[model samples]
Target: MGKITKYLNQLIVGNVFDTPEILEAYSTDRSVLKIKPKFVAFPESTEDIRKLMRFFNQIAAKEIPVSVTARGTGLDEGGADLSSGGLVISTEKLNRMLEIDPRERLVRVQAGITLRELNTALSVSGLTIPIGGHNNDTIGGLISNTPVDDSAGKYGGIESFVERVEVILANGECLQTSRLKKYNIAKKATEKSLEGDIYRKISKLLKTNAELVSEMSKNPTHDYSGYPAIVKLQYKDTLDLMPLFFGAQGTLGVISEVILKAVPLSKRPSRVVATFKELDAALEFAHKVKSLRPRKINFYDLKIIQEARESGKNLDGVIRKLEDGFVVLVSFDGRINSCVKKVANIQKEFPRNTKFIFETPENRLILNEFENALAAYLNSAKSSERVPILTDFYLPARNVSGFLKDLKVLEQKLDLDLALFGSYATSIYSLRPKFNLEDKDFNKKAATFLRAGAYIIDRQDGKLAGGTPEGRLKAVVTNTNMKDAEQILYSEVKRIFDQNNILNPDVKLGANSKFTLTHFRSTSLPKIML
Candidate 1:
C-alpha cells in the first residue's frame, strides 16, 4: 500500500491519497455499491491525467492490472464510478472555467465542474445548461451517465448540448472530438497514434456492420444503454465521436474538458403542484399537461409520499395533501396567467378531487424544492438504507400508469416496496426500493426483483435504461435486453477505444449479473460531504 501510494503521489502533479480514511471515503458513491479502490488520484492538470494514463498504459500488461474509473462528483446511481482494486481518479480538483463564449452561447469548462457551480458562474451572463442534475453532480458525470433530467423535456438530452469534448484516451493520448466532416474523418484516420487508429477502426466497423448498427438504432433498450448507435454516430456529412462517449460511463475514456452549448437563461417559469387521489388520474392529467409543451412535468406516485412519512421527512405544499395518490409538478415558460389557462384547459380531464398549488416566484426554485423533496427522505434519521435496485426505466406515456401498476404487483409479490419518481413527459424514471442493507438475502432478493421488474418493463415496451445509461449496475438487466448484434457492435466499439481493456473494463458494455451482485454494498455514507 505504501509503495503504490508513494508511486502514485510522485506520478501525478496533484495529490494521491491511499489513507484508510480517504480510501473508505471514496469507496461509496450515491449508488448502492461500494468498491474500495487501491488509490484515489486528484490530478490538478490535464497533463497530470495524461501522465497517469501513460503510466497505466505502460503497466497495462504488467504484473499490475489497473482499471481506471474516473468520477466527477461520484453521484452516479448506476455504480459506474466504482471498481475493485484499481485507481479512482477524482475530477473535483480539475474544475476550471477554461473559456466562456457568451457571444456564441457556449461555455468551455473542465468536466469536473458541477452543474450548479457552472450555472452559478454563468448566472452573471444569463446562461445555463438546460439538462440539469443534483448540485453535486459534475459536468463529466452529467455527460457520462446522461441521467434523465426534467429539464431535458424543454431543451434536450445532455447529448444535444455537448458541442465538443477533450478526452484522455486509454493510451494517455488526448483526442479533441466534435462533429467532424468527411475530410476531417479521413484526416483523423490517417494519423499514426491511437487517435487515428480509433477513427480508422470504428469507421470500418460501422461500415462493415452497417445492418447491425441500424438494427441497434431501432432497439429502444439500446437508446441509452451502452454506446451510441453507430447509425446515430454519423449525420449526412459529418461524424461525431462525442456521442459515443456521452453515456460510456468512463469505460471508453476519461473526459478532461468540454465545450457545451448553453442557452439564454429561462425566464421565471410558472410552476404548480397537482395532486391526485389515484395514479391513473394523475398520469392522465400529466399527459394533458404535456400537450401544452410545458418545460417539465415531474411525476411521483403515492409511494413517494409514504416513504417520506416513514422516513420522518415532511413534504410541504400540496405534495403532502395526497393521502394515497400521486403528485405532478408542472412548469411553464410564461406568465402565471398563461399557466392558469393551461391547467384550466386540462383540469376537467382529471379527477374532481385533484388539488393544485399555483406557487409564487414563477420559477423552478419552488418546483425544484418539490422535486428535491423526494430525495429529502434520505436525510431522515428514521430512513432505512434504501437500495436503488430499480432505477432509471422509461416508458411511453400510454404505458406509464399501467406498467407502474404492474410494478406495484411485482412489489407486492416480492414484498419489496419501491419509491417512484421521474419526468412525466419523457417517461424517464428514478425509482428506488427500500431495503435493509444488512439483510443477508439482499443480493439474491435484489437480483430476483431486478429480473422480474425488467421482465414487466420489457413486455410493456419500456426501456430498462431510458433516463440513465446502463452503467455497472443496470448493465446486467440492460445487457440481456440488447440484441445479439447490439452486443457485438458495442463490444467492437469498446475494443476500438480501449485496446488493452484498461479503461473501466467490463463496465457499460460487458458487466454481468455475478459481478453486479458480488459488489452489492452493505455500507453507505452521507450523500454530499459538503
Candidate 2:
C-alpha cells in the first residue's frame, strides 16, 4: 500500500492542502525565514485530531516521523513554522466555543478559535478571559504554549486563566491534563531527569522537531518554537491550565481545547498619562505605579511621542514637555470611583517627579499620536543616505536602569539615534537604536550592536531568562556560560518529545543560540543505520 495515500485516507473532517501557493503561504510567518511543508491539514473537530494522531502513531510504528504545527497570527518570533515535512495539522478549522460554564466562571473552546473571536462572543455575556496583555492571540495556542505579556504583572499571566486542556499525544493517545500537572512536572524535573531508550527515541524524534522549527522561520522576536516537552496531567482546584501552556510554545502536544477562567467586563476605564524628563524618571514612575496596578502602562520616548504631536492635534503643553525624554501612560479600569481614588493616591505618592495628565476628550483624540510620529521618523529615514535598522533588547524589571545606562554608553560610541521605552506591564525595556549603514554594512553593525549590548549585560552580572528571540539570542551568543547552559537544556528537552524524527526534517537541534536554521548534509546508509 502507498504510505502517503494510506495516511491521506485516514484523515477526516479536515482539508489536506499541498499546493505551491498554500505551501508558500505556510512557509514564512511574521519573521524572516521561509520553509516548505509537504502537506498541510485543517481538522474540523477534536475527533479529527485524534485520527491525525493515530496516523502519526502508525508512522512512528514504522519508524517514520510526522511533523505537526498550528497557525495563528504569527506574532511570535516565527514559532509557527512546520517541523519536518510529513504532516502539518492546522487547527484553524477547529474554531468553536464548545462550552461556557458561567457558574464555574470558565469557558471551553476549540483550539482553532482566535482571541478576538472568543472575546466578541464573551462580550455579549459581559465576561472575558484573563489572557496576556495582547488580545490578538488564540486560546488553544496560548494554552499549548503559555504567553507572557503586559497583564503578567496584574492578572498573573496566560497561565492564570487556563483551567484545563485536551490534547492528542504523539502516540495517538488522547490525554487530558489539568493545571497542577505542570507543578508536578516542574518538581519531577528537579529530581534526577528521566533517562531510557524511550527517552532516547523521543530525543531523536525531537532532533527532527528542532530541525523543522529552525527551518520554519528566521524571525527575531519572542518566539520559543519548541519547548516545555512535559505534558501536565493534573491541576489544583485553584490552579488553572494557564501555567501548562502559556509559555510552553507548543512542544508537548497540540492543544485541542482549553478551559479558561472568565472575568466580567469593566464598568469604566480612565486614562492616566505621565511624562518624565528622562528614561530613568519614567522607569521610576512605572515602578511606583506597579503598586497601584493599573490595567496597562505604556512607555514612549520623545522620538516616538512626536507621532502624537505631528498629527495636528493640540496637546496640553505636556506634549511640548515630553520632548525632554519619554512618557509613561497608564489606564485604570474598574469602578470609576475606585479608579479615581487610586489615581489620586498615585499622584500623591510621587508628587514632585511625576506629571499626571488626564486624558480628556481632546487628549483622547491624539491617543495614538506617537504612532504617527514614528511613521514620520521612519519615512524621513527611509529617504536618507542609509536605511535605519531596528533592533530591540529586553531587560528584567530591576535591570531596566542598568540596561539604559549601557545603551547610553553605547550611544556615545555609535553615531545612531537611540530611543528607549519602558514597560509597566512587564519587567522589560525596549530600545530602538537607528543608524545609517549600507545594505552590505547592516549585518556588521547589527552584530556589533548586539555584541556590545550582550557584553554590557554580562558584565552587569544579570541572568537573562525571557525576551524576544533577538534579545535572547544577543544574550546567549554574548555570554559563553549561558550559551552552554542553553545548549544542554535544549538538547535534553528535544530528546523527550519527538520520537519519529519526521517533524521538521530540514532543521537541527542544539545547533544555534537562537532559532536560526543551519544546513546539514546526509549520507546514504543501510536500513539498520540506527
State the C-alpha lDDT per candidate: 0.78, 0.54
Best prediction by TM-score: 1
Question: Model 2: how large is the Cα RMSD against the reference?
Answer: 9.5
lDDT score at residue 453, model 2, on the 0-100 scale:
60
- 135 Cα displacement, candidate 1 (Å): 1.6
Q: Kindly list the per-residue Cα lDDT of model 1 for residues 1-530, writing each as its tens digit.
A: 58867887787779987889989888878777888888889999999899888888788857466888898888788788886778899899988888898899899999899988898888899998776567778889888888777777767768788888999998899999878899999999999999999988988997898776776667545358867645677788788788887788998899999998888887777777888887777877887777777888888877676655665544564465555778888878756577678788677666566777776665346556566567765554234565676777877777776787787788789987665778887777755666666778888887888788888878788888878887878788878767777678788899888877888885777676787788888754564422
- Against the true structure, candidate 1 has what lDDT? 0.78
How many residue pairs collide in each prediction? Answer: 0, 34
Q: Which stretches of candidate 1 lie over 4 Å from their true place?
A: 218-222, 306-322, 349-351, 361-372, 381-383, 527-530
Clashes of 1: 0
What are the root-mean-square deviations of the candidates from the true structure over C-alphas?
2.5, 9.5
Write model 2 residue lDDT over 300-400, tens digit each, in one string.
77766664355443445555454557777776675556765666676776547667777666766565453244444434333232121222334556766
* Error in Å for residue 71 of model 2: 2.1
User: Given candidate 2, what's the lDDT at residue 435?
Assistant: 40
